[model samples]
Target: MENANDGKYVHINGNDIYYESYLHQQSAKETIILMHGFLSSSFSFRRLIPFLQKEYNVISIDLPPFGKSGKSRRYRYSFENLANTVIQLVESLHLTKITLLGHSMGGQIALNTANIRPDLVQGVILLCSSGYMKKSKPLLILASCLPQFHRFVKRRLERSGLENNLRFVVYNQSIIDKEMEEGYLAPFLKDDIFFALTKLIRDREGDLSKDILNELRVPCLLIWGEQDQVVPLEIGKQLHKDLKKSKLIVLKETGHLIPEERPEEVFHYIKEFITDKG
Candidate 1:
């Protein structure tokens, strides 16, 4: 285990998962865990953390191979493993019951974890979550075998350019500021990420099936962006149907980055839902 201002690292399953803990009032009973999407880190939750920490203990995690976490070539990057890693982290912290708030790929992981161990999770909040996706194509899997192919991954990602990527992430163009751009680009400055991503492509499995999703009894609150290009509102609709205990809210003029696009509104809904459930 290691500690730094960026966050604290806990060794789990042979990899160090970097995370920042904002333990608000010790009297606060609920703990909310924040999980970021693919290629994103704890940085994405910066806007919402302050609001949550004021009322609940908030913990933001940088999933393995992203942010300051260890980028291990041997660690399996499958969603199940990632979810298990998250579970291990919760166990390590001796958390009794927790709520998971995950965006995009992180939401997928959140569902996977809840389904695996319902007793540990009190509820889940999925922000424009990715759902019902097929596995990586055979061609991509074969390409992952090429020696030093990580360079190609790096090149393709860099070619897209940070500004262009941010434009796609949020519907409000004016919100794309220097800080947001720099936050997303910071981890890429590390050369090891490309190789980890290469391994990730080969290890990733398809999203959970409807039958599996149907088994989850944990309550959920899903917030979606009406104009989300990455994961559409329909996907959230499908999730609401599959996860029987879930309710979804869609925000207008919002895109893939729900938290970044509507932090205050999201917080309001979250407070209402959590408080009502309690």
Candidate 2:
């Protein structure tokens, strides 16, 4: 499934993980691993990958049950397991020092990975992440309780026309082109994929508030969309307050999908951060 413009898969843990490797031709000394949010794939980094590849070996992967990756009904989709799979990918690729960049659910996975294997990661970048949000919508809370119900709802939403239903989740409707909508819909169309997503949501619905932010010692960057309705701007502010070494950049006229909505701005900050660290 290798395309002329995108990268191919490398097998890991009986799953064919889809990833795009950029700057492989160049002699780069650093590696930047990009992880996309829930229901999203490596395609989320389409805008920033080319720019970052100029200096670092940039690699982006589609999380399990998302994108071209295989989904299994038997496996549990917890953040810890996702983090382990990511660490395996890093080790399998022989990446020594990595700058991990994660968006939304991917941000949670990145933090988990960094907490477990701090030595392997050099820095962390989180975009509109979800660890700090304690309260969600009542429907989301109910869906978390009933996994099957959640899958059914997601299916109904997608079949009923995802573009319209997803307007609330995305900041700008124009950012979600036909291809992007199709990409978002692809995973939920599969039964196994739906099950995996349900499991992930259910597993992370508890109160994760306390003091998890204090565990992060790596240099961190928190980017948020001021108009974000999914994970609210307040959550990002709370994250910045809790994480001492982290810096927050709130972009105006942006929503949950910061990387997609404002790719150039997001990339500029990320590039500057990488350069300063290097």
Q: What's each prediction's TM-score?
A: 0.96, 0.86
**lDDT score at residue 267, model 2, on the 0-100 scale:** 84
Candidate 2 segments exceeding 4 Å error? 1-6, 133-156, 201-209
Candidate 1 lDDT (Cα, 0 to 1):
0.90
Spell out the clash pairs found in candidate 2.
Answer: none
lDDT of the structure predicted as candidate 2? 0.77
Q: Relative to the unseen true structure, what is the Cα RMSD of model 1?
A: 2.7
Reference-based TM-score, model 1: 0.96
Q: List the residue pairs that clash in candidate 1.
A: none
Error of 2 at 24 (Å): 3.9
Across residues 1-278, which tens digit of lDDT does each residue of candidate 2 receive? 11234567776765668877775555777788889987788877777776677667788888887888867554556677778889999998888779999998898888888888989998899999877544356777566667366567566666767776567666777777788777677666657676666656655543234466786788888999999887888988888887767899999888888777888798899888877877
Best TM-score goes to which candidate? Answer: 1
Query: Model 1: runs farther than 4 Å from truth?
Result: 1-6
